[model samples]
Target chain A: MKEFKFLIAIWKTNLQSAMEYRGAFLTQTIGMMVNNFIYFAIWIIFFDRFKDVRGWGINDMYVTFGILASSFGLVSLLFGNAFMLSDIIAKGRLDYYLSLPRPVLLHTVASRTIASGMGDFTYGLISYVASGYFTWDGLARYILAMLLAATVFVSFLIFTQSLAFWLGMMSNFSNLVLNAMLTFGIYPITLFDGYAKLILFTIIPAALMGAIPAEFIRAFTWETLAQLLLGAIGFLALAIITFNIGLRRYESGSAIQTEV
Target chain B: MKHFAKYWSIFQITLLNSLAYPGEMVGRSLMIIPFMWIFYQLWKVTFSTAGADVISGLTLRDTLWYLMLAETIELSRPPLARTMSENVKDGSIAYILNKPYDFMLYQFSAAMGETIFRALVNAIFGGLTVWWLVGAPNHPEGFIIALPAIFGAWFLQFCLNAMIGLSAFVVEDVSAFTWIYQKLAFIFGGMLIPLNFYPQWLQTFAKMLPFSSAMYGPVYLSVAPSRELFISVMTLQLAWITALTILLIIIYRRGLTQLTVNGG
Candidate 1:
């Protein structure tokens, strides 16, 4: 419990430091917002041309994009620094977190918050509201889906970052992988057939992260809900295992002392 | 001649530096391939069902070949002529300028070397993968006709990117310009979808724009390569490259003069 408090303190301090750089923080926030808005524009063009793609209406596309944007936004807001996990590990900055009296993973994640992520969150919320897909009837399911989506996204970061143990320069690799997944992954999973769908659900988990959960809410299916729950659990387990194995390989040295 | 040799040496060093990071090179190349493949698959589905034998004068095969060629070409081309634009803004350009070679030529050569290396690797592996999976273009002449046109496209793109980078001289923030240029390329250059897929008016407008030469013209050359088409596409690319290159030289000279005058 004390460790948890310490972790939270660390997060607060980092956020405060970031707030000090108001100009950079604001620019980055606006940049992320504009970056996400462009894709929304592209989707508008897509739906404009084809009224419905594989039974996916404009409304459904908006929901998928919103859920994805929001889920990614949530991750970025709370654990945006997690994206830099590979870099931290590579540079032996993990030693600082390890020395702290907290779960290293928790400390690592809580160390930094992205002010820019607020832009993504704001854009996503606006998109969801604008899509008019949100109704009180499906509110519970949407919230649940958002929670599960966040879980899967966090699990993905953990899994990818754990790769830093073996791959020294894994940050760029992780970024490339994550970007590809987000760009190609958010579409209707059903558009993909056979082994492609299998890969999306299992290896990349893009389907489960964005598409499946949104699909579940749109057309509530016990089967899909179950799959999502199971997938989240499975991914969490995998990430934990990967992190533990990486921890075994981690060498605790005075690397952070020099930085200090 | 001495300057040329120094620039050549810098290019060689850059190439060797990239070669040292073989794992990164391979991983990035592998990562990009799947996304390209997905684009191919999506376009195939879109074209397969459309009853119109020709969508904007492009047949199904033409469309598919266009996609394949564009994916390969986009990967092969360097991201910018002035990747060091940000470096200039942050004053790291000072270290680069202190080197024996001209800073502009050194960076340009480095970008070219990296692009050449990526193209060779991507072509041999990525080309075969696409060919084996999607099958080669129906028209054999298409590949031959596209070769020179593709070169022109690369040159034009490089010049335009350099121009965008040159904006650093005037603009306090050039990153926004870079972002806008890349987004424009993705949208207007037909990287997202073929220009034919756009409305007829938009298609006409896109073709008239310089950005289309980077994307649409090469795709057109690859899918339906005729003597006349090749000449027209290459001529336009050459015109843009010459114009942009001259503009770049002028801006660079002016920027340098200002830098010296201000002691920046």
Candidate 2:
């Protein structure tokens, strides 16, 4: 409860800071929405010529894009610091978190919020509703899927960021991995098979982000739910373990820098 | 002679700096594969669904090879607009202006240097993937035409990006413009879907735009080339290059006049 309250307070402050530059904040959010819209437009164009790809139609894309966008938005909106972890580590900026009273990793991950995430979340909800498949049961499955998807996204980021501790100056490589994962997640998972699908479900977890969730929502099955649950827990555990181990080797530069 | 030396020096330095991160370059190039793979499957399914030997004058092999080449064009362009926007936003562009070199020329040289390296790496990887899996382009004769056509396409992209970057003098950031232009290029320039697949009106509209010169012209030459197509493609590319270069010059001049600096 206390942690939740603290997170709320942090977001409140972050929102206030963002509001200081109202125009720029609005631009960022709207730009992201337009960016995502263009991608959807391309898919629509594809479907216009061909009815479907392997039983997956434009409607399925709406679901896939919806789930992926919303979960990504949630992570960016609530845990924006996760994306910047590698940069923070490279710059030796973890000292402030360590000095604070709360959990360093948690605080570090939830310190900032991205205004664009609001746009992404809004777009996702609209897309999902527009797909004409929303239901009470679908909503429940969607919620569960969001939890698993967001966990996988944050965990993957943490796992990559932790590499900065050992590798040092890993921002570029970390960014490349994250970009590849994001690109993979936005597409239909049915498009890949065999070894590619296996990699997606395991190392990258792109399946958890969109496909499995969309499938489970289409047809609620305990088996799929169990798989998602196991994947989330296993990935989260790996992230936490890697981050903790990396934390031990962290060396502070003792340079004073303040971020509001 | 001095001007050439100045630009050459900037190009050499930028090229050397890119070499320092060869691993990152290769990793960046590797990103094209997943995109190719996804498109490969989608096209396979698309062909099977259509139940036709050719759609829009392209066989399955032709479409896949076109995609590979299209992706190479997409991935190779330098982020010149972002670099310029950052330099302008931070007021570092003022520092560059104070130096002996021409600011626009310096930016162009730096972009060209990095772009050449990136294009080569992307082509090698993208080409290898196509050969390893999809064999080769259906039109081998078009490969010879694509060499100069692709380079012409890159120059056009550089000009467009330079103009956007120069707009930072009036706007807070040009990144929004960049995002929009990229999508426009992807859609109208036939990055994934060929321009011929579009309706007649849309294809005509796309042909008139410079974005088509940047992507469609090169990829079109690679998959389906004729003497008339070659002449038209090269002519359109040269014309756009000339037009955009003039626009870039005008923008740089006006942008410099309106520039404001803090701590003056």
Candidate 3:
């Protein structure tokens, strides 16, 4: 309970700081929302000409984007520091987190928030509705999907950022993997087969971001639901284990300042 | 003619600086392969649905090639807007103003140098990817037109981004402006699907915009290498360049006046 309170207080302070630049915050939020919307528009244009891709239509795309945008937004807004974890590790900035009594990774993630994620969260809901899948059951499934997707997204970041310990400054590699996942998430998964499909489910697991969740929502299956739950839990465990292993390799280098 | 040597030296420094970051270059280049793979799959599905070899006068092969070219152009451009905005934020523009070289021209040369190096890397990587996947599309005798056309496109893209960067004088952050500009270029400029696939009205609207000249012109010319088409596209690109350069000059003057008044 005390740890939760600390996390909330830090988030509140970050939100206040972000609000200090209200105009910039709002512009960034809306700008990112529109930036994501353009991807959907591109798909829309493609569908307008070609109508469907491997039986997946524009509406499937809508929900896919919806889940992706919302889950990503939630992570960025609430746990923005995950995005910069590699940099923090590479720079030996984990000293501050180590000094704190709380779980370092959790506190580190909750330390910052991204304002633009608000736009993504909003865009997600709007896209869900626009896709005409806002029924009560749909909403429930969507929420569940978002939960699993968000978990996978966070775990993915942790796994990538943890490489800083082994690789000794691999922020570039982390960023590369993250971007590849983003590129894969926006595409229709039905088109991928063979090794590419295997890659989507494993190494990068881009499907968690959009495809599997969207599929479950489009047509509910207990099997897929089980797979998503397993994938999320499995990936989360892997990330935590990897991070802890990396932490064993971490060394504080050239500390310039001391904090009690 | 004398200042050309200055720009050349700056370009050389920028090129060498980029080469120094080999890991970053390789990572960035490798990242594009999946994007192209996705595009390949999407276009294949679309072609299968259309039941025709030529929608918008592009075969699956042509569309795939077009996507590679468009992505090459898109990725080659430097992050001019972000760098400029950072300079403005940190009051480094003042230091730049005191430098011997023209700030805008120096930055442009740096951007051009970085872009050309990245473009060459992407061409090799993307070319190999295409050759392995779908084989290279046949080009007409006038394939040489693409060189100048693509170079012109890069300049136009840089000018647009630089204008957005200069807007940092007024705006707290120009990321929003950059995002809008990039999306406009991607959507209307024929980055993913050619403008030919767009509806007639959108096609006309996109044609009139400078974004199309920067992206669509070069990609289209690569596939349909007609000399008449090349000349017209190049002319359009030149006109936009002239107009955007004048706009950039006005923005730079105003930004400088603001900076001086505010004691940047």
Candidate 4:
């Protein structure tokens, strides 16, 4: 409870700081929303030409994008530091988090907010509404699915960035991982088969963050719910384990600098 | 003739700098592999569903090759807008301006130099992936034929991206503009879908845009080589190049005046 309060306080301060640059914040938010919308337009074009690919159609795409966008936005907005953890680790900036009384990973990840994430979050709801699946129960499912998806997404980011503890400069690799998730998360999981299916479930787990959650939202099944829960819990556990193990190897850069 | 050598040297230096971390370059280029694999699955499913070997004057083979080349062009692009925005943000543009060479030519040369190896590597990876999925390209000569248009495509990109970068002089941040421009290229430039598959009205409108010239036109000729397509595409590319190049110059001059007043 105390840690939750601390996290909320840090988020409020970050939000206030972001609000100081209101125009830039709004521009970035709207820009991100429109950026996401434009990618969806490609699907519109694809559906227009081919009707549907297998069982997936334009509607499925809408929900898929909504879940992916919201999950991505939520992580970026709430845990923006995950995006830069590799750099923090590389520069030994973990010292700042270590010195704080709060839990290192929790406090560090929640300290910054990416303002553009608001756009993605809002746009995602709008996408879900437009998906023609908006209902009382469906809305509940959507929120639950988004939380799970965000969990998986942030865990994937932490898992990849944790490499910085062992490898000094892993930002590029982290970026590749991020890009892979973004690119694959939007596509229909049904298109993949065999080894491709194996990859989606294992290495990258884009399906966990996108398709499985999307499927759970569309029609809840015990098996699908099980998969989503397992994935979110599994990746979260993996991320925490990796970060904790890596934390043991942390060494301050040894160049003291003042932090206001 | 003497002035041409300056730009040539700028290009040469950037080319060498791009090779500085060969492993990083290869890793970056490997992105095309997944892209190609995904494209294959999508197109194969589409072709099967359509129940036809050909759709919109393209065989499945032709479409894969078209998309591979298009992605090669799209993925290999240097981040000219982002780099220029950084120059503005860091207040380094003032120093860079004092250099002897023309800024536009210098940027263009450097962009092309950086693009060469990245484009080559993407084509190789994308090519091999597509080939493995759907055999070889219908016309190997398409690559040779598409060379000039490929160069022109980069020229078109540099002009528009430079204009977006220049907006940073006023806006101080150009990421929003760059993101929109990139998405526009993806759609109208046919990076994701060939213009051949677009609705007729939309196709005609998108073709009129410079993105078609910058991306789709060149790669289209490569997939289905034709004398007429070559002539037509080259003509369109040249027309847009002249127009955009002139517009970029005007914007460049105006940006300098803005920088001088504010940067002071």
Candidate 5:
């Protein structure tokens, strides 16, 4: 509860900082929304021709995109550092976080907010509504799915970026990993069968962030719920354990720098 | 002439400079593997669903090879707009403007220098992946025939990006414009879906756009080669190049008047 309060306070400060440059902030946010929509437009064009691929139709795509963009946006919005934690670690930027009394990872990740995430989050809600699955129950399920998806997204990133503790400079690999998750998650999960499906569910966990949650949204199934919860919990545990282990090996550059 | 050597040396130096970080270059090129693998999965299911080996004059193999080539061209192009925007932001454009060489030509040579190895590596990786998924391209000799169009495509891309970069003289940052242009190119250029797959109306619309000339034409020529295709694609490319270059040079001249140093 205390940590949650701390996170809220930090997020508020981040929002204020963004608002100081309102024009730039709004440009970035609107630009991101337009970009995401255009990307989704390609799918619209695809479905117009194919109609459906293996029972996944345009509506399924809408729900999956909703789940994905929302979760990804929430992660970036609240804990934007998840995207660049590798660069932070490599540049010895963790010293500032370590010096603070709060939890290093939480404080570090939540210290900044990416304004564009709000755009993505808004677009996601619009996507879900456009999906024609609009019901109170559907809304509840959508929010729940988004939470679980966000858990997997952030945890997967942390797990990938933790390699920086040992590897030193891993920003490139981390970016590739990030792109893989985003690219793989947006596609129809039915497109893969054997080894590829296994990799998605395990290594990248993009399916957890996209298709699985989307399925849960389509209809309540205890089996799907169990899968989503297990995947989220497993990744959460893995991220925390890996990060703490890597933390022990961290060497602070003790570089003196100032922040406004 | 002496002027030609200066730009040529600039291109040569940038090309050699790219080799300095071979690991990073190769690492970046490795992106094509996942992309091609995913393409294979998606297209395989797509083709199997269509229940046809050939759709819109392209077999599944032709489609994959076409996509491999398209991705190489898309991914390997120099970050011209971004680089120009940065130079404008940091006020390095002042120093660059003072140099004896034409600003556009200098940039063009450097961009080509940076492009050569990146494009080569991307083609190799993307080609190998597609080959593994299916087999050799439909026309091995056609790729050689297609080479001139590929270079022409790069020239078209250069002119378009150069014009976008010139906009930085006023906007100071052109990221949003670049992003939009890139997405527009993807749609019009048939980066993800081949032009053959689109409905007739959309296919006709895309063809008239310069993006097809810049990206799709060369790849299309390689996969489904013909003298008609070569002549038509090359002609379109040449026309766009001429038009865009003239417009870009005019914009550059106008932009020079507006350029302001950041620190001053």
Candidate 6:
């Protein structure tokens, strides 16, 4: 119960900070919407030229893209600071979180949130609805898939952040890795074959996040649901293990004493 | 001549600095593989059917190889434009101005040095990896002829980027300009798709623009082009480079005068 309250407090603080910059926040939100629309436009052009790209048509692509974009937006909106934890850790600012009464992971993850992600979420919602890609039955599966996707997204972020404990500083490295994952995550997994597919499913799991879940949405089946559930559980376990391992190497900071 | 020597020395220093970070360089190089894979698959799907020949006059194999080479070359190009804007914002440009060398020449040399280092790394390692995994271009002769055109493309890109960076003289915030420039490059420069893939009228317009010259022209020249066509592309690139270079010089002179007057 206490931890729950702490989470709320952290979220409220993030919201407050975001609201502090009214004009810039609004501009950033609009800018993100424009940016995401441009990417969608590029993909639409591809679908226009090729009727069926690897057996996936325009509607199928939109569905997959919608899920990925929404999940990405949700992750960024809630856990933006988690993405930058590697940078904070490298700069020795992790000490501040450690000194807090709250769990370091929770505090760090909730420290910052991007208001612009709201724009992305809005865009995703509008695209999904306007395209008529999801039927009534598919909607239920989509929601379930989104829940699982969120879990995996947060877990993967934690796994990457934990690297800071061992690597010392990994802001640039983390940024590069995350950018690559984002770029890879939007496309259908079937496009990848052999070793590439293996790597995406296992190490990066970019395929399972959207592409596989998307398959589940298009054609709901027990087997597809099982796969997503299994993957989500496996990734969550791995993330927990990685974080704990990193904790063993973590050194507490003196700066925390002064800050607190 | 003396100023040239000074600028050359700075360029050498920049080259040495890049060489010092071998791990970072190798890591960044390895990172391009996923993007390469994405483009490779995208073109593969687009050209998998026989209809590919009708649209672009490229076989599936030909299109894939052209895209592969173009992506590798584009990735290897130095990130000069962003670096210049950063220098200006951080007041590092002041130090360059204090020196006897022309600030523009010094920055250009540094960019050239980094570009040369990156090209060497790409050729020795990146080129080999692309060949072993994705397969090399069908026409080796085309690849050879594309070299000068590629050099011209790089020069034109550098000058255009320099001009974009020069906007810092007037704009309080240059980051917005940089963001717009990069996004435009991805679209207009044919970094995302071949210019030929666009509508016929759009393709013609893109060809006339300097951005397409940076990415698409080189790829087209590499696949299959007559000697005359290759030379003509090179000449156009040279014209853009000359015009952009002259514009940059004029902008830099005026910007410096403005800075001096404002005691900046």
Every model's TM-score = 0.88, 0.94, 0.96, 0.97, 0.95, 0.86
Docking band of candidate 4: medium
DockQ of each: 0.34, 0.52, 0.71, 0.71, 0.61, 0.37
Better TM-score candidate (1, 5): 5
**TM-score of candidate 6 versus the correct structure, residues matched by position:** 0.86
What digit string (tens of lDDT, one per residue) describes model 4 on residues A1-260?
99888888988888998999999899989998898888789899989989998989999999999999999999989999999889988998888778867799987788789888988998998999999877879889999999999999899888889889999877667877888888888888879999998898779899988888889889989898888889999999999999999999988986345432
RMSD of 4: 1.7
Off by over 4 Å in 2: B262-264
Where in model 5 is the C-alpha error above 4 Å? none
Error of 2 at B108 (Å): 0.8
lDDT per residue, candidate 1, B176-229, as tens digits?
556556667767788767776777777787788888887788777778878898
Which one wins by TM-score: 4 or 6?
4
- Local distance difference test, per candidate? 0.73, 0.84, 0.85, 0.89, 0.90, 0.72
Error of 5 at A40 (Å): 1.8
Better of 2 and 3 by DockQ: 3
Better of 3 and 6 by TM-score: 3
| Per-residue lDDT of model 2, residues B30-145, tens digit only | 87777777777778778887898799998888888898888888888889899888877887877888998888888888887898788789888888877776787778888788
In the range B1-264, model 3's lDDT, one tens digit per residue, is 997789889999999999999878876777667778788888888888889888878888888888888998898889999998888887777787788888889989999989987888887788778767788777734346688899999999989998898888777388878887888898999898899999999899999999999999988998888879988998999999999999999998898776522346
Q: Which stretches of candidate 6 lie over 4 Å from their true place?
A: A114-119, A134-144, A170-176, A193-196, A216-222, A252-260, B51-55, B78-101, B123-125, B166-179, B246-264
Model 2 lDDT per residue over A1-260, tens place = 99889989988888898899888778777877787788688788888778788788999989889888888998988899999898888788998888889988888888888878877877787788888789888988887888788888899889888888898877667777787787788777767889989989888888888888778877799988987888889889999999999999999967446755
Can you tell me the DockQ of model 5? 0.61
**Candidate numbers, best lDDT first, in rank order:** 5, 4, 3, 2, 1, 6
Where does candidate 1 stray beyond 4 Å? A1-8, A114-116, A136-143, A219-221, A252-254, A257-260, B51-54, B77-91, B163-177, B250-264
Report clash pairs, candidate 3.
Answer: none
TM-score, cand. 3: 0.96
